[model samples]
Target chain A: MTTQQLTQQIRIKKSFLCIGLDVDLTKIPQHLLELEDPIFEFNKAIIDATHDLCISYKPNTAFYEAYGIKGWQSLQKTINYINEKYPEIFTIADAKRGDIGNTSTMYAKAFFQDLNFDSVTVAPYMGKDSVEPFLAFNDKHTIMLALTSNEGAFDFQTLQTNGTRGEAELSGAKELYKQVLETSKTWKNAQNLMYVVGATKAEYFTEIRKIVPDSFLLVPGVGAQGGSLSEVCKYGMNTNIGLLINSSRGIIYASNGTDFAEKAREEALKMQQEMQQILK
Target chain B: MTTQQLTQQIRIKKSFLCIGLDVDLTKIPQHLLELEDPIFEFNKAIIDATHDLCISYKPNTAFYEAYGIKGWQSLQKTINYINEKYPEIFTIADAKRGDIGNTSTMYAKAFFQDLNFDSVTVAPYMGKDSVEPFLAFNDKHTIMLALTSNEGAFDFQTLQTNGTRGEAELSGAKELYKQVLETSKTWKNAQNLMYVVGATKAEYFTEIRKIVPDSFLLVPGVGAQGGSLSEVCKYGMNTNIGLLINSSRGIIYASNGTDFAEKAREEALKMQQEMQQILK
Candidate 1:
């Protein structure tokens, strides 16, 4: 998926909502568990019902991984279902993976080549060599962790970055997330890079925009996390409207009854309507 | 396994060497490809040949993930084989994973409960909440990435973190890794924590030791990555002799021919001998 194609999809659908298919067995309808692959069956229903209302589907790898080999197979089936049916919709394998260079190359092959996700989320604590391998794949995207949407974000991402570079006379330390934004742009194939900036940090988006004006941002705090969609758009919307606002629990787990897929579709429609209004 | 048991094993064997099982198809003996599960067969042979030499087996998740379901099953088989045959040997899933609290809990279950790994590596980019879930598992351990051995470590870990609390007039930013160590100590269940300090940055150990005096560190980059074993022990060693020096390529891919397992055993034996001298 190219940058232009994603932008085109957002405009055509009049929505930039990226629904997170983070399915939990306990949370899904009780009837679905009788199936051989309950997770995939539940995801299939949800995707079939709400595919047109959203531009992307993000399957959080942790949820699938909790069940072991069966969980991995369900994940494979869910992704295959998406790609085969909705080829136009973008896909994200929300696996927060990063390692050393050679190992990272293997991961790139896993998601981008074999599993065939358009993008995968990566944690950037290991630095350039860990990330460059993912960026090297032009057709694929690497969504990096910049400022996460959790309370722990303040613990490290927002810390002031000072001292190590020398020059005390220089301006005060830049925040860690800001430092990440600036440093990562200079790396190899950074053009293929996008950042994960929580939508809850709408205030920070104004400043974040100053650093990464052109690159798309995958924002995850819009619905269940108490982030205002309007506020995020006010500060985050670029010329291409470079934002992929995500909603997981608020959309997928809308109800536990057999009408779960219908409820999910209703919730997605509400979000799509709001996005349509904003895109106007 | 508990920390005491691990330390005892190190002393009993007179070695703290950790052999990384990062299997790749192209690098393994070509004959194994004909087997029903080549990766598992290869890992089984390596484990059989060198089980007594090293204290721990660190299988990087990326290598297994690249092969998809087959790769994941191979990983399951390898871990099961190690636990069944050599129950006393410590196991490390060198998977650099971290996420929000709830999601991380699933990951903890995936690695510790389902797969039955003693420890799993996690990245600290998401802060305390992300790491706390992993720490919550009492019988298991969480090894956080600190100063990595790769060249990219300089990109962020070493940067000075300068930020202030409200009216606190906080001091200038400490190095990112130091901040991680200090902040992580204050979190709940921090006793289950270890850290990854790359052997390539052996000189940083003196400063690192002051921050984490008793915690065991999983150190990579001993042989293949140009790290000196003697230099790593000089500053990083604790009274408990807390260090697990890892060598992936140097041990596993020692030879591409049919003598691969023997060559791998020879390399691991060399590391074990060196570690014995250091322990003395």
Candidate 2:
């Protein structure tokens, strides 16, 4: 989906929330475990319960992949269900994939063409050619990691870089993530780029916004990860509501009883209600 | 498999050659296209033909992921075939995966436990928390990207970083990849760690050896990507013959006809012979 379509959905829903469909069978309701495909069933219920409360669904591939072929099957089912039922909802495959030129194209085809996700998260460690393949697909977004929410983000993302490649604007020195943002803007078909900036580092958004002000930031460290939604929205939002505040365990696993979906909706409703007020 | 077992296999086989099973449909022979599972058939042929010439088989995950479910199935079959038949052969899942702590654990499980790969490649951008989980597995190897073969490697991996976290070595400044090597060594269960250092950057291996002399380096970009065997072996090899030099298109796609497997064996044999001479 285009940014315009995503923004329209956010306006209609009154929430820029992107609910994370990161399912783990052990964490879901005990009753659901008896089902043939517990992961897909859990996701289906959560999506049905909270579709109106959020504008997007971001499924981290790791959760599905851990289950092997059955996991891939569940992922295929979940994505197909989303596209068939809620065509308006923006889907993000938070796969964190990147490789060389041709290999990356295969990945782009896997996520964008085959799976039909509107966007897929990519790691920026491999640089331009690694990312441009995803960006080449018109209107299909590529969310590259800029500053992640994990403590590991500080390991390299925030380290000061001695700028090369004619980066004179930052006075020859800046953080690695900023360099990633600036350098990425110069690549071919860069307009299709979005970024992954962790909500835990809300203060970094102000600086991040300066570099890619119009680009959507898929913020994933909220709620269970201890990132405040208000602080993230305070600095990260643009006129188009270019922030997808993601909540995974906090909302999905709110209650593991039979009313798990209803409880999830309640948790999602709380975030959406706050977002409704914030949108005003 | 443990590093000791891997080294023993390398010594016994008299080859450090690792054949990359990155199968693309269009690239394979025309006859295989008619099969029920062409990808798996193709991989099986290649593995059967060249098992003696190579110490390891590194099937890049992108090639399998591209075809979605069927592709993943092919990957499963291929890995199973290698494990069941050539139990002595070291297996590397060139997945290049990394995420937050718990999530990384899921990915580690996906490649290591579920699929039963001896080793899996991981991207080091996320730092200690992301990678330490993969290292936690016993008898399994985690190969982290150091300096990649692609041009994009120059983009972020080569950028100079102002050292923090009390890294006083190298006068408080070094390239991001070097810092990756140094920092990874400090993580828990680091003995299980290996690295991916591209053969294209043959000169960089000299410095990389200083930081990780004992750890195995999975060097790609040997033939098809224009990297020299002798150059990488000269600078990268340790007392244990610590290098798994990979060649994908150069060997596997050497012939797309009915004699494809024979041609692939011929190509692998050439590399194995060269490696044998280097061993002497």
For model 1, residues B8-72, the per-residue Cα lDDT tens digits are: 99999889989999999998999999999999999999999998988999999999999999999
Report RMSD (Å) for each prediction in the order shown: 1.4, 1.7
TM-score of 1: 0.98
Model 1: which residue pairs collide? A160-B162, A161-B162, A162-B160, A162-B162, B161-B173, B162-B173
Model 2 residue B185 lDDT? 90
Candidate 2 lDDT, B112-208, residue by residue in tens = 9999999999998888898999999978999998889999998889887776532333447788888889988989999999999999989888999
Stretches of candidate 1 exceeding 4 Å from the true structure: A163-172, B163-172
lDDT of 1 at B197: 94
Model 1 chain B worst lDDT run, 10 consecutive residues: B163-172
Alpha-carbon local distance difference test for all models: 0.92, 0.92
Model-by-model DockQ, in order = 0.75, 0.69
TM-score for candidate 2 = 0.98
| TM-score for the B chain of model 2 | 0.97
